[model samples]
Target: MKHTARPSLLLGIALLMCACSQQPDRPPKEAASPVVVAPAPQTPVDEVQRLLARAARSDPATANDLRLDAATELADRGDTVRARELLASIEGARLEGPQWVRHQVLLARIDIEDAAPATALARLDNPAMQTESAGITRATQVDLALVRADALQALNRPVESARERSLIQAWMSDEQQRRANARAILATLSQVDMGELGHEIGSATSDDWRGWLELASIWRDLRPGPNAQRAELQNWQQRNALIPSLEPAYRELAPEILERIKQPRRIALLLPLGGAAGAGAHAVLHGYLAEHYRQLQAGESAPPFAVIDTTSTEGGFPAAYNAAVSDGAELVIGPLLKEDLQAFAGNLELQVPTIALNFDNENPLALPKLYQFGLDAGDEVAQLAREADNRNLHRTLLLADASPRARRQVEDFNKQWRARNGVVLDTLYLGDLNDYRVQLERTLLVAQSRERSDMLARTLGFKFESEPRRRQDLDFAVLLADPVAARSVRPLLSFLYAGDLPLWATSESNAAVAGNRSDQDLEALRFIDMPWFSSAEATLRRSIQAAGYSGAIERLVALGVDASRLQSRVGLLTWLNEAGLGGATGELSLDTQGRIHRRGQWYVFADGTASPEKARPETPDPSSTEGGTAWQPQEQAPQTRDAPPRITP
Candidate 1:
């Protein structure tokens, strides 16, 4: 919540215009001292004038009291400059109790308005204000807390601001004000990263703080759909029954979500069901239907689904999409290819709300109703670049295997890194397994260091021994490789004395085996990948695998699962810009351009196990790579699949 002053000068102008005719040439001195013209002042200008007049005629101590009232009136009117000046004229040490607390609060309010949150917080945190806090009125207490929260928010301390808001929530008497305050708390908590919020929940000592954090975490989780989110909400309520301050906000969620849960009279999956892309299309179809069936099992309402095969139609996506709309599909969830999405970019508007399965890699024209949600490699690169920037890793080294996809990823990272003014000291493409060490040594400056050491020994005319040192200017390295290449290259870098350098990688480098001793070679390497790989989502992965969906293609299945889950809640993502929908592929959030960005879970390989970064370690077997390795899907499923039924034009 925030407060602002209006045009008090205009109020003064109106007062002068009305009173000019009533005044005599020589208005009496007593009149000059001013009487209460009316029982209540007409506006903030009148109130401030009346209080200042009374202060002029009162004793020094009482005059200071009236000045405080005048300052508050000025602040309420958004005349903070005048409010601050009036407040400064009074001796702060002379005030006590409620007046003293109010004095500090008003000063902090002015500081906040001046864009100095630290100064505002410092004034509010003063010991003298706390000493007299007990004597402050309920309204004053709320004001104190509100200002403190605002300062904290301005300083980017979202969790602490949320806590402060929660503290004074009950003190708010107006029902509307209380509800707004609760929303303010939620909005602030939403600004926090989901991963950070999870950690905060674990360490939170206050029941109130933990409840708010948990609620936010629940909202950010990758659930299957609105039904799953609502279920999680119910679970949160069951877990935290005692903290009722946020009940109004929690109660407010059900109706809004329930409305979304009832939306999209029908959903259409437009895919190339009988062509080269048939298998992937069928996987998507299966995953979407899986979520639909799962919701049906839970007795939740879901829109009827219709499938239209783009490949069977002569006109392709345009014809298939028309068919879906002709069948009363309120929301269309496919045309699952980049080329199909290119058709969307050509249109000025889409007939129905469309969630395209693939993103147009070329410069895409913005469409009002087109929402792109797919497993985009660019999203991971952007996230990693941001993570590296956040860690202050300015100077970077890039290493990638010789592959077309790896080349594209490297180019994307360079663009993102350069956009941030980050320096890429060197970039190397590893061509052969035999040349891995040589490539690393040359790019890392290890060979150069060894040459320099040997040259110095020869100049000394005696054998002087010194170990070679790699370049120390680099802050981190980006490795673009698969698990196999990473396994070989990571250990070699360490042996070459560049082991201490932090490595940031993409999901491609993540191995399928968990806690495999062979993974010991990948220890401490950080990578970002789909939530499907995370152990936390093992149940969801198992459910998909149980349905005969496995291997690399499972990623597409996960994409389809998210697409189904996202159909109803797209509005939620749009409404709350910071809100994220949890999905099998990643934590999904929407951008203003109608592009959905995925933030994958971060993992660090530790002693042969790829565990969630900074989270508690899971026990690992000390045996071989095969021992204690959790069963994940192989690169390819065991059997060949049959073609799904074709959709005729």
Candidate 2:
């Protein structure tokens, strides 16, 4: 009975437990829904501002960093005032390493923007903020160095600026970065005076630095073509083998610096031997042959040469070129006419190098080894414009003949003069030498002055004894006239009461030979011509005459002689214009467009003869003098001569 009662109690207990467990499991409390709060969107400025506000509450150093970053952004956004205020709020004393550098660099940038280059330089001169510092990144160092270089440049310390730029290269590990820095330094050094630059290069403390500076200097001055540049680089390597630090830089530049130009073994001559340009072509040929013979007499080996006539009706230019090529000619020179040059423009599949004697009016297709050599009138006028600007002659009068050639000269002169900020007071085109008085009156506004004088006289009821004066605004006169017209026009200018005004003329204004009577009228006329024509050396004159070349053809003869000598050195001319080939024609340089430019000697008609003019002193800086009158004529012997007759083109 006790067991049965115990069992019933156990069952009752189990039932009670079941009832407690089954009493509807109260729904488990739902897990609290995650409070997903979406973050609010913010702009760059707002985010930076928030960062600044948070940093200020936590870390002072972090706050300063945020302030600097915000300042840079503000400055970039053209809010410089706010940028400066933010920058000023940063406690600079707490910054270190790259942060300190950033602080100083930002200040320097602001100073530079304010035109305080000296202040900018001072800020960047801290020794602690070094590029070699492990805490600073290479990119940051380069950027800092660039800003310093710019500050130096703005201060007119280009040498110092170049040195600063060189620092960037030293820190650069990337080849492209090094090359870009080197180019920047070279470009800066190019604008510095050669003498000053040489001094700066010589003063370098390290052999490596000196080597780099020298390389840059050579590159800046010579601007050598691929072949010439390779030669120069090779020469540099030979001389600078001791500079251990420069090897990597040089090796990296080898590909860009090394290219080869084929040496011509045989050459063919082309000329208009029987046409309007026949005389000029013959003179050139004679000169060329004379040079070749001269070289042979000097025990030098001469290249094999052949002649092809472009004027021959039997075979044209193409046939001549083909025949020359077939004969193993590696080079050809000729086609001394614009039409001939234009005709050959379409023939781009030239087998070998060919130099044309004339240039097409339009830009021609750039074929391999096709060059143009001619006495370009446009070059002369451009040079004249430079001379005028150098002398500070701001206002000029242009008097040219009515011919097409003269008109072209005037147009080129006008374009060049205006390019230099010069003012063209007036331009006069004269049809006849006899009409000089009328043209001068109109151009000089003398007739208008005279008319005013008559009106004044009528109003006053009396005529003044003094004649009406010419306009005083003209600082100089450029006369593009033939010798005949120049002879007549020069004296006419004096009679027109303009003798006191300075006059400049082109080579065409002077005669190769003139009588004393004609020379008397050409006194004070300054012109430019080839050295072969104006050389005072009696031996040179005798040699030229002995060669049977004179007058208008003398220049062409000189051109031919230069062409022959330059055959082997044409690559040099293409790159190094400042180091020109000292030719009989003049200092000759070949431009990138394949045109030869000759810088001629200046001369003045004196004592019934033309004499080489002494080089004038360097013109004073316009800002250094009152009224900017830097040009003053040197006293010259008074002489005159008749102008030579015009040559038909």
Candidate 3:
């Protein structure tokens, strides 16, 4: 059969096969039209505002939630007006549980922000709002409590504020939050009057919370000694044995309580006992012993003490300090001269607590257990600036002697004055006490008055009687000079028609001795000094005199008395700067650097005698207003007196 087919037939069959194989395949199905999705709707308002608008169109309750959130943001930005408007829209809206509480809280917050704490307080006190409800979450309750506390604080109700703050612990679970709340409560309590605090604690209902607050209040007033404080704490613990909640706080405070009770058994006094510094040292010793005896007479436990004579030894302060330490001295107080103190503080490996009787102008190394206390004029100058600041006397005219010591005082005053944002109108240095009119006229700008007088005389073509007037720009004048210079300068100020201006001076303006003819000239001059110099307490003066201390040494005697008493209280003073101890020197407080500063009562010379100025009025509570900021004014810086001229042996 293959042989019978012709070539044309075979060729046709091959062509047919090729045509069938060349047929095209079907095309792939077009990708399914991509599913189109509309983009999210964008609104002009923020998310919260848009949500509120949408919810308002449908669910009013949801609308209120959004509005509350939006209002909270507005309030935070201090936009009270708009926040109030948003809050008003939710008025009468049916809300419950957290929503209701949140609404109330926000309303109160608005009141607080607007400085209407009383109004806020009234709203928060509603009994219906205070009751726990199924809708109120623990967090919402906490917010309500915090808002209430804020309102109470704003209203100046510290007791109420503290009580409200204590309630927060019942709702708060976070430890850090609880600690923060506790600090706030304690700070509020701190502002309360001590007597009032005691009264509040005493009147509180018997409860674990009240007991905790009482414990804190008692601890604050307990004796500074660790032993005394611990005893008090233990007594409180026994009384509050059932208060398991306070266990953590007590445990935390235990170590500090123990440390505060520890005290040195013996103290060593190092002073120059020979040469020019000898008399001053003796006066100090006399005062120290006088206080020791006084304390003994009062049946108080006085620590054993020893005196080492640094001037008597050839090795000076270093040998004496080493000898005293080797003799079992637990504390050292001495090296009266500034140079000796600097040398001792610098060279010695301090093993025990020390209170240097003088301060170094140089920035010396700060050693642990080292304290500096002295009769430096810098203290008085700083106090003068504070008094002026307290009196609202922003502009000051400084009149001081030209001596280096006086200049140093002026420099210190300027430093403190500048710190308080005071303006120094002028600083006049009086070279000669005999003639201060020229200096006064120049400093007070009285030359302008003289020029005016000359102009009037020239205008009228005749001389006329006239007194030059001081510049009115100055609010107060600070005079730093000795009694001799002050006596001469005071009358001159009056002669120059400046008697109307308030004049403030340091202790140096008044002669410590009574019945001075110069006292007449010191009339109306306000001054500040230690109680030992200005006090009318006969017993104190007699005790000092009985110690054979008099004249300039009398002040040194008082310093010694204060120094001896301060040894026991150094720990207390160091820990709490506001805890003032009334000593012979004045109200004493220890600065952060262990420098003791004194606050003297202001005194004014009147009717031929110096009398204490009236006590200043109590500062009004700043929280009384809607404004939450406390407005406490800065008080006088504690001052130290200047050293009298060294008496020769």
Candidate 4:
């Protein structure tokens, strides 16, 4: 279904690169003739920066274009305030379609990532973006499409995210068409003059392994069925092959690199063995301890685990530390809080690989050997984005509240989505929960139109696309805000649900309502979440309850336990990962940096209440538990006749 590439695409940049030097497509309209190219030894910046300095030399028009480009660069480097200053210098009214549209896209993306989706949406709300206006020209459509997609994913609509995928899919029908379409989209975007994006994709065949792998990952991640699967493997293989170049220090030096990775001999367990987190700590300990017994049962030596109370007085820490280390400990798990870490930091020597729940990135004085491995926000988003990609979701919009936390989430998600070549529609911000309906109406309707939908109507064939597809709006969104806000957004959900838009969520949506559940708008809405325990059968439940008993009665009765350990870990990790949209606890796999990659299972709400669509397996027979171990006979005790002997001898 992909339309063949137009003559305009062939005659564009690729052709220009083949012929080394080309005359100006048009003289600088500002009438400043002869732009200079610097000498050989000059830095790359020297040429680009020099012309930009005298941008205003000829006139305001040249100055505005140069200002836009400069502003975009600043924005790319995570400097919004400075970028905004440059943007203010440009007169928005003076710029034309593609240039003007590109400026709006960048400005809006910055606002969105900074948690001002409201402002970002305003910038991209140009009428030309919605329709093929006589004046807009085709060159700007793709940019508008990409930015609009970002807007949707931010809003928490995965099904609608799929629709955005459908939109991109229509641009290219088959596998080859999709890759070419992606290459085309990247090619066009490269010209938009966004600072980093320009360098994001150089010649794909060149030495730019990161760019190539990134693009290949996106393309293969999006395509579905057999062909897409094959493409995905090939692309991943290509990426793996180029890992050495992409991470020079990572792959090159042999033994030196190997030595840097400290393999723990014996890990010291520091956790709340006697407080609120005690049950959870113990439940985790059951797993860690079970790992030891299981290893020993398999004829492998069990690593000794030296457990300690993570919550300890300042005076107790040094003694406990010395004790654990003296016992051949090569690592430490907790001492969970910041106070304990700071108190012990100065006195501690680098004797073990410490796994703190807290990261020293925020605390520069953080302990030397400590590697933090708690729930990180970026790790969750990275995982969630991968899941979204696996589901073939092409377009993602991000909607976030205005806050530093929300903005950071936006930045991480943006980087991930861009890396995947997925489109971010509009990341809208919420000022007041009351304005939910009004705000969403503008977002959903303004971007979608009758004319384009009518033309693309027969084009997009998914069942969900019946009316919504014909409308140029996004079908899914990522609401990167909290649950309280989402609960308030029930009315907004009304707007979306009426349109049959499926709303997706991060872990936040599962939070208990502060007030009434009666008014909760999100209950019926479907989203993906991570459960700490993948197997939620009755047997799994009984096994976990038995593991956390504090009383004989609780231990004797499989039905009772002080707290629900399995649910707690799953629920907490679900929330934490949602803080990243990362997957489950048991599978909580991450890269060396502790970013979650392969974790969690995705659940959709098929019925009214939240339930797992897939059923979990029951516990195996005790005889068969250890990789089909032989059923052993139970030992019998000898009986005594004490009462008979006391009768009268």
Clashes found in each candidate (C-alpha, N, C closer than 3 A):
5, 8, 6, 45
TM-score of each: 0.70, 0.60, 0.61, 0.41
TM-score ranking of the models: 1, 3, 2, 4
Query: Please, what are the lDDT tens digits per residue for candidate 2 over residues 493-599?
Result: 65565666677888888777745567656766778787776433244446667867667677787778777766655665554233344456665666667777766
Candidate 4 wrong stretches, greater than 4 Å: 1-267, 272-303, 316-319, 338-347, 361-371, 387-395, 400-407, 418-425, 428-433, 446-471, 481-491, 494-499, 511-528, 536-541, 545-598, 608-649
Tens-digit lDDT track of model 4 for 164-257:
3224433333455444443433323211211122234443343433443343223212112222333444454455454432222123212221
Task: Give the range where candidate 2 is weakest over 10 consecutive residues by summed lDDT.
Answer: 1-10
Residue 86 of model 1: what lDDT? 74
Best by lDDT: 1
Residue 263 alpha-carbon offset, candidate 3, angstroms: 5.2
Q: Relative to the true structure, how large is the alpha-carbon lDDT of every model?
A: 0.72, 0.63, 0.65, 0.44
Candidate 1 clash pair list:
5-77, 5-78, 221-582, 222-582, 222-583
Please give the ranking of all candidate structures by lDDT, highest first, separated by commas: 1, 3, 2, 4
lDDT of 2: 0.63
Give the best candidate by TM-score.
Answer: 1
Model 4: how far is 404 from its true place, Å?
Answer: 6.6
Error of 4 at 389 (Å): 5.1
| Candidates 2 and 4 compared by TM-score, better number | 2
